[model samples]
Each structure stands twice: as structure tokens, then as C-alpha cells.
Target: MKEGWTWRLPCALASALLLAACSGGGARDNPDDSVLHQDIASGRAGAEVTFDGTLRADPQPVGTHEHLTVTTPAGDVLEVDHNTSLAPWVPAHAGDHVIVHGELYIDPGPRAGVHCTHAHTSSGCPRPGWVELGGNYYE
Candidate 1:
């Protein structure tokens, strides 16, 4: 009986080690490498781009920050930081399509924001003063 228990303990330890090895590390440990590895490898890091996608509004705030999800035409999803004041402007509907223009801060994670100086868009892309964040626009 003692031998059986000892053998089982070794098996359990080995199983745990194997599981740990397979799991590896998490995103928190290497945020930059985890987030921008593909972009860096592809050499498309600094390209100014416009992505068209339907918006997905989060049910709850993300990390104490207002979050907006843009599902690109190619089906790629981008999580954006709408900042503070812009939160009120976010569209309530999840399916609204929008074209966001801003520098893609890819390293830490893909995030874009239109500053308070940018003009609001009643329809189409933002024009020039204080643009809203997630509001639905007809275009």
C-alpha cells in the first residue's frame, strides 16, 4: 500500500510539470512580444491604415477604461481605447460600422483614439473639432 501511494505521488508530480510546460507563460509576462510579434515580423508596424468594421460595445468597462471593439471587414477584431470624455459618444448598437483613423499603437496592444480636437462625424469619417467616440453615423 505504501509503495502504491509513493508511485502515485511521482505520477502526479510528473503530470503537473508536463501541464505547466505545455501551458508556458502568459501575456502579462511579455506584453510587447505577445502583442506585436506578428506585426514586427511582417514589417508593417508603422503603416497608416484604415479598417472598416462593425462596432461591438462591451457590456462593461474594460480595465477602468472605456473600450470599443471593431470587427474589421476581414473579420479581424481590434480593441480600442475611446478615452474618458468620448465614452458618452459611443454608439449603443453593436452592429454599427465605422472607419477609425489614428496611429495604431501596436506594441502594448492595438489601440486608437481621436483626440478632443478632432471634429465630430454626423455621417462618414470624422471631419476635422470634438469628435464623439462610439456614436452611430450614417454614410
Candidate 2:
């Protein structure tokens, strides 16, 4: 009887392990790689990243910054804040596709964003970022 129970214990353990694998092996430490909700992980403040997205709206003025909303190819919606002096000079519009390289910040509602597209006089700022559109680059 004890020998039969020993086999049952091993079978139960194997079932649990199989179930864990089927359920994604529990939660990941970071889920930025998932296309459905990648922004939450990838948008850690101060990290540099480059991605392609379609402009969802015209640049809006947010105080001294120029803000643009975009939809990533992976279906993530992100906002961009341009604080460089050239913010007003960089033209963008809805439906335009753009390639962007920048430091990402997590913002409420909008979630991910890029800012500090130019050199910062202070230390500990994110590296300069850039936006490339239609053969032109703006930083």
C-alpha cells in the first residue's frame, strides 16, 4: 500500500509541473516583451529605445514641450514629449509613419513616452533622443 501511495505522490508532482508550464510558468519578472501590453515593461524611465510607429495625432503643445501620440506596430499607444529647441520645427501629422530613438518615460493614461531629445546640461538625464521622418531627423 505504501509503494502505491509513493507513485501517487510523484504523479501529482508531475501534474503540477505540467500545469505550471501550460499556464506560462507563472508571471514573468518583466512582461515588456508581450505585444499586447509591452509598453508597461519597455517604458521604464531613462532607458533608450528605438521603434517604428504611426502618428495618431498632430503634435500638441504641452507648455514648452511638443507632444505627439503614436501607435506602435505592436499595437501599443504611446506619447512623445519633445523638449528640445527644435520641437516646434519638427513637423508631424496623423497617419504618418515615423522611426524614433529616445529615452522612455512611463506616463499615466498615455503610458509610454520619449523626452529629452537634446543634450542636457545636468547630470543623470537620459541620453539625447531623436525622431526620423521622411528623410529628415530631428533631435
lDDT top scorer: 2
> lDDT per residue, candidate 1, 21-134, as tens digits?
876732111122222334434545443344446677642466634556766655556665544343344543577655554334444454433222223332423432221234
In model 2, which runs have C-alpha deviations exceeding 4 angstroms? 1-39, 86-88, 119-124
Number of clashes in every candidate structure? 5, 0
The local distance difference test score of model 1 is 0.45
Winner by TM-score:
2
**For residues 1-139, what per-residue lDDT tens digits would candidate 2 score against the true structure?**
7658978998999999999988787432222324323545654666666777789988887777788787876777778777755443469899988767666778776467776654442354446556777867676
Tell me the spans in candidate 1 whose CA falls farther than 4 Å from its real position. 1-47, 57-64, 86-88, 108-139
Clash list (residue pairs), candidate 1 = 90-134, 91-134, 118-129, 119-128, 119-129
In order, candidate lDDTs are 0.45, 0.67
